[model samples]
Target: MRSHLLNDLTAEHYRRSVTEGVERVAARLATTERPFTGVTVDALAPRVERIDLDRPLHDTTAALDELEEIYLRDAVYFHHPRYLAHLNCPVVIPAVLGEAVLSAVNSSLDTWDQSAGGTLIERRLIDWTTARIGLGPAADGVFTSGGTQSNLQALLLAREESKPGRAAWEEGASLASLRILASEVSHFSVKKSAKLLGLGQDAVIPVPVDQDKRMRTVALAHELERCRQDGLTPMAVVATAGTTDFGSIDPLPEIAELCARYGVWLHVDAAYGCGLLASVRHRDRLAGIERADSVTVDYHKSFFQPVSSSAVLVRDAATLRHATYHAEYLNPRRMVEERIPNQVDKSLQTTRRFDALKLWLTLRTMGADGIGELFDEVCDLAREGWRLLAADPRFDVVVEPALSTLVFRYIPAAVTGPDRIDRANLYARKALFASGDAVVAGTKVGGRHFLKFTLLNPETTAADIAAVLDLIAGHAEQYLGESLDRAS
Candidate 1:
């Protein structure tokens, strides 16, 4: 076991292990067809448990063969054209190459000495992102695990920024008086961040949204006024760049004005819409994002990169000190005083992966304009899908999509009641998933079930969406007929 370890002493063994593993993965990618096999946990758990890790196969090929049966075969393939379920995107080739290189090196980006080149690469990427965001000269950011962590860190900064003179580090009393105002349809992470930061869930005040699902500026103003009247401090105004369920972008300019007038920190969660940063045509949709005090961007969501690539950027570089802690063994005070760039000073994680390498390689190979064009393609496809859904009688399509998500419910002519229609839609979605033909998502609006099509794959076309819609209609009709038979 000691000889098999990836230490300097076992360099040859480590090289052989990695080389064989890459070959197997590449072969699997070349052959895989569908997005998912729809294997339930009950069926997969038993088979996976049969693998006896106590007895090492010793041979990489044999180990990979067994691993394929237990894990890879059932894994969801984002590259598949029909995988329109969530925010997952098909990864670019260059990013995959970066993943391979980063994994082999295993560079921990927390310290300067441990990851000398990796730290510089990550900082360069962060600088590039801040420039794209137009965060001005004082902008700074740190790569996070994902959007959730980014949101968490952004809120943490906002909390600290709201309490300037007080010792916030030792006290939870000031946090109780602080409130975070967010759109009702904003990502759930805002509320979760509040809970984790010692601000009770009740501290989150939900601002109403208009019919298009955008944050209503008038409502936000009223809420802020109410907070003032109640002697509560508005710590942060969280605006969604791309909401999860509807893909609606809030009116950022209006929200920004309100935050500015009220002197509250504005944090924009752009996890789903950050790709617009590179968009040639659709970039203006994110107007006034530059006014935000903090912003969250998830590359994995819309930048066609792999998972675990995101960053939280702040307009004021000084705000990042809130997350910094001096460790004697790691990023100590002396190192910082000497002007060393240690990433862990701004990060919540000490053992962070070199995820920025993926985005850097992607930009170099694909070019920012090329990536933007791909994002434009998906947005165009989404509008086309909206037209298709609106023209069809079976779907009660909601308002026109602001981005790449369509939220609608199946409404068969024969189905009269809203309750019955809700049941049919729910059943249809489950049946479609079980059949493994096309994977779509589901959500609820106004307490009624609605099916969703989250189109993040540029390869997916109008015809693909049409086919999935037809499948959904067929399942819904079948469910209705079955329900009628049972009633009779």
Candidate 2:
């Protein structure tokens, strides 16, 4: 039974297995022709379902071969030039190395006893990120699974802080008449967080945005005043640093000043634009992030690090105590009193991964300025793409992007109706994805479907975007022609 155990269970066996797997992945990535294989679930499901999990393959080599066929063969390649889908970035090499090292070590970052060096390294990275945001000396943070978790934790802190007399953590205590004010286009997580915190979805007041898709400051002020009139406590105002669809950054300076005037917690959801902290050229775009009570940063999005590398930084470190818990066996009160840097004191998760290592290695190998330059490259590419799209008569593009995303829709000469145009754009997106020619994203604006190009890859160029645009136009034309033929 001992001999039949997993290869990764032992140090020597783990090294051999991991090296082989990494080599195979590297080779596959280099040779893969398409960004996605366009393998349907129906086709792959039977093949995977046929494999009996009860029977174990004794040989690691044989298992690896089977795994490649079952998974790697159809995996979407983010590094591909035409992968203009979501906010996924082509990860840096140093971050990949860090992922490999951290997974092998399997260090749990909850307590100092479990991860001494890992704890310190994560703390140092937090400090560095805090300073980058110009958060004052008392700023502190904790690494989270991703932006969703970071946002959730930030709201949780706000909820705890908003309570009046007895702390929310205290026995027999209840919540207040708390309401979260956020842009109508802000991340869905704000509403989800509200629900999770027992505030219900209706507690989130959706403030209208301007024509540019940015939160209208006047509208926000109106909503805040309305909340007061309704006897609802405006607990927190979530200002989006970078919205998902339009990449439009809310008026953070104005939003921050409003929050200060009302004494409301300002939670900046900078998950998508936090990379600007390192951008020497575009850092000014995130002007009032320092004034935020808490800010969420997803390093994986723009910092070019792997997934699960994100943090929620607070302006006041004392606010972190809201999430603190003292476990007798894990992070005991004695250890915390002794000034031990137990990460569990701040994090919502008890057993957290050392995801900070990825960002640390990335920063160590490629300095902050280099990372910023990479982000700037993508932003530059987006501007070029925007110009190309706007100049073309075949498409209706939105306003100039604030970050590295462009929203547009194919508008053929014959398709004048709004419904027809929406169908054409949706059809084009699906057709292009199914053809495996190029992968792109779509979102609805004013109930009309629009294609989105979230350009996070610095390697993607104007030529690549131009080619993708051509493909999209071709698909849209094909769809329109088919629709006309059906009508005739």
Candidate 3:
């Protein structure tokens, strides 16, 4: 136990153990041919269940070897070009190096005493990001676990800001009266946040989106008017910079103008589209993001940082006080007088990890332009894929992609009923996942089943898209044939 402790005396031991682990991971990555092994849960679960946690493997190499059998062999590799399932991106080398360093140092970023230089580094990064978003001089934010927490914190601030105004307007304005207007297609986290904030079940009023999947400003205006007429507090207008399913960017300038007119706090959930902030070619797509009262950015999604790197920025730094709490043993009230920078003063979390170091190292090594270029490649690839899906007679593409996601479904040439088509598409997605040839996602658009291809890897090309389409067609045809045989 003494030898295992990570101190100066055990530095050599730590070095050897970590080196061996890195080598195993690198070797596995180098040789990985597919995104997945298509291993079923039943087959893999028992191996994990059989392991006794109390029985410790005394040697690092032995533990790693055992880990290879149950975990590494079947772990889905996002770096693989065929992994077109989700928003996960292949992490950059520099960010991975940062992860290694930060994990070893184990710095808690909640207080200046715990993190020292790390607190300043995170603040500088926050300043850099807020400047990029053009949030002005008073802009400030704290790092969060991910976009979910970021969105939650943003909504929390909006709730706090709205409560006083609403209470003054009416006798008893409670959480139930607060309404959050957002697109019907916005990320599910918006609704989840509403529930967690103790708002009413119907607190999230879903605004209609256009054919492009972007929110309709006219409909939003109607909703705002209705809320006022109903004596409801229009707490916030949650506009999505990039919707999850369609990657559609809502009309930000129009939405911002409406929020200003209505005096509603504008919160831009730019989790997926924040990459466009760094985009050389598409920065204008996020033109009115600067007008947002609050913004959520997920670096892990588009910045190519590892998981759990996100932040919530505000135009007014003072608003973050809604989340602040002073403790005698920790962030005491006197610390403010002493000018001690405690991240917990603005965060919903305490004892937070120094996740900012990863982004810092990544920016230092590759710069924001490098990240933007990589994201641009994926977006460009998505356009090419859209063209392929549009041209192909076997598929029906939903809409032209605004970012890096394409939603389309297979359509058999024969006169098949919509139900059969739905089943065919669903079956095809499952079959492809089971085969491990290529992994794709599935969603329902307008109550009809559709397949989704989220191209985050720059290595994924037009050829890969073409090949995956053929595989899907083959699988769909096989399913239809099998269904017909069963019916007969």
lDDT string, candidate 2, 1-488, tens digits: 68544445566776788789999999998998778888888988988999999998888899989988889988888999899999999999999999988986789999888898999999999999999998999999999998899999999888888853135467545555688999999999999998888885578999999988899999999998988898878889999999999888999999999999888999999999988999989999999989999999999999999887999999999999989988898877888669998999999999988999998898899999999999999988999999999899998898799999999999888736888888889999998888887899999888889999999988788999999999999998898889889999
- TM-score against truth, every candidate: 0.96, 0.97, 0.98
- Per-residue CA lDDT of candidate 3, range 166-218, in tens? 46336655667889999999999999999998888999999999999999999
Query: Which 10-residue window of candidate 3 scores lowest in summed lDDT?
Result: 164-173
lDDT for 212 in candidate 2 is 88
Stretches of candidate 2 exceeding 4 Å from the true structure:
1-10, 164-176
Q: Which candidate has the top score in lDDT? A: 3
Ranking by TM-score: 3, 2, 1
Error of 2 at 2 (Å): 3.6
- Local error of candidate 3 at 388, Å? 0.2
Clashes of 1: 0
Model 1 lDDT per residue over 137-245, tens place: 8999999999999999999988888863145665634567789999999998998999998886688999999999999999999999999999888999999999999
Please list the C-alpha lDDT of all candidates, in the order they appear: 0.90, 0.90, 0.95
Task: Tell me the spans in candidate 3 whose CA falls farther than 4 Å from its real position.
Answer: 164-173
Q: Pick by TM-score: which candidate is best?
A: 3
The alpha-carbon deviation from the true structure for residue 265 of candidate 3, after best TM-score superposition, in angstroms, is 0.3
